[model samples]
Target: MMQINSNPILAFLVTLIFISIPLSALAAKHNNATEKLSLNQDDIHGLWIEKRKKKLAVWIEDCGNALCGRIYWMKKPLDKKGQPKLDPHNPDTKLRNRPRCGMKILSGFVKNKENHWQEGKIYNPNNGSTYSSKIELSKSGILKVRGFIGLSLFGKTLKWERPEQKLQHCG
Candidate 1:
């Protein structure tokens, strides 16, 4: 005959280790899921800042049943003469006097099949050129904006970050 004995503490220790390991893994997974960025289209409405090197803050919002964004703020809103910065580089001479601040730089962005904003135009105040553009908000909260003349393959993408605090429009 074989003799069998049960130890309560040893059994409890085994149970705890077995239970806690999977529980820990599950907890970590849940945390990661919660951290994932929102995929909802409306989540894109907010203030975004490009690389500080540009010193620009853009405000994105719903407009005319689509997405639109504008430059509401700039680090230097004035020119050397202490006057509002103008879009002198614009091809259209009439629009050259428009202020860089409060300019409608992004327009006509509609949601595409992939939920990204597409079929839009982004105006480059630097060179006063407009390019067909598309935008996507990533799972990590980075705004990926692409500007291309013809195909997306022939373009550049810029990553914009969200500022921690509210930024006042250029004054």
Candidate 2:
């Protein structure tokens, strides 16, 4: 006759179940954090203005590999003459060619760290140039946007305020 220790089997089962519970909870918490950090199209669907002067509506949609932002609406469409205008002094010709509306101004923002995004690109309409950009969302609902040329030492930072409207159209 073979004698088996039932205590060992029961103890193993309890240990396994106990270990799985916390592991599953940890996994769920991790997944929730990832979901929160993800930049969804609806999360950025609003009008964001630069210094409360130049109003530009930003639409957060996917670009092929990552996420991108497009200018869907603008406050000023044309100059005094109402002609198809151009940003002549813009440093980047690519950005200069972009019209007031439907211009892709931001791209490639990957989630990094906690509530901080890096590895992004931002286009400046004033200079018509693209620079390495980074965006961070503060607890106060302020977006800190920084754009640099060569290195982080040489860059400009801009704080954009979130707009109120859900949908905005160019006038």
Candidate 3:
């Protein structure tokens, strides 16, 4: 006669369920940190220095219903051939030859709260990828820009600061 013993498997499954409950709760808490902030057009406007490189700057402007940002300046504006650097990494062949400067890297960001812009996309010219994005102005005047692929939890946050020296354009 053969007998079945399910006690060990049942105990293990129960342990997994208990462990997952806490893990799920932790994930929810982490996502809440990405919630909207209190911000306005004026706070987000002007040139901002990319955290990764201070020499690179983005000009943020008000575009009727939404806000947009473009690559306004770069430490090395020109290549060895004395020509403006181009978006060589762009996925679109037609756009690949376009100048990196003045290219709008940020788009479709609409104000979601008094301090947060949501439903936006941020383009990384280097990698030629665009991700879902949001923007928030911190109390210290730093812009907290978050870009994600699937969920806000699975994204990165970059701090952008207003340039001390203003550029000629951003209107």
Candidate 4:
């Protein structure tokens, strides 16, 4: 057997290589993970109906921190009696007070687990109630949204389907 001298330089090089390999791999894996959640503007654009409400349209978009959703359109502006008024004792006035055409009903949604997103709020225009909300994207392009009083078990779930694209006419 031949005697081999262990050099500090070789040991340092080996340690550096080992650390770099895993670091680079981790970076690549992170990139791939983010790519999987790549959401396009069109994917969330258009009208979305609130399952609880008969005819309400909430539009989803990308907020500064995470994804945001708002009420961009509605079937009617006034109540059945044709009066433009808001409920005085409503708890979700911040969301439902504005005109239906431009209301931010959802905000601060962060991706959770795999297909679900948490840390968001959903506001109900009917009763003016805002609750903690979670959103899940299904394979069929349907968004399952849950808004609860305290926990998810105590609230209601709404499923909104992606609406058909419409042509914009500017006259």
Which is the leading candidate under TM-score?
1
Model 4 over residues 1-171: C-alpha lDDT tens digits?
422236777777778999999999999988965544343212554456655554666777788878887665555656677765344436645534545446677988888776678999976656667799998877766778889878789987888864444422111
lDDT at position 152, candidate 4: 87
> Which ten residues in a row are the worst by lDDT in model 4?
162-171
TM-score for all models, in order of appearance: 0.72, 0.62, 0.70, 0.60
Provide the lowest-lDDT 10-residue window in model 1.
33-42
In Å, residue 138's CA in model 1 sits off its true spot by 0.3
lDDT of 1: 0.83
lDDT of candidate 2 over 23-139, digit per residue (tens): 999999989756544423225434466655655666666677766887776777676888544566576556555456777778998877665778999987776678998887676
By TM-score: ranked, best first: 1, 3, 2, 4
Best by lDDT: 1
| TM-score winner, 3 or 4 | 3
Ranking by lDDT: 1, 3, 2, 4
**Better candidate by TM-score, 2 or 3:** 3
What is the RMSD, in Å, between candidate 4 and the native fold over all Cα? Answer: 14.7
Clashing pairs in 2: 90-127, 91-127, 92-128
Model 2 segments beyond 4 Å from truth? 1-47, 84-98
For 34-123, candidate 3 gives per-residue lDDT tens digits of 322222224688778876577678888987799999988888788899898888888898999988889999999999887789999999
- Candidate 4 local distance difference test against the native: 0.67
**lDDT scores in order:** 0.83, 0.69, 0.81, 0.67
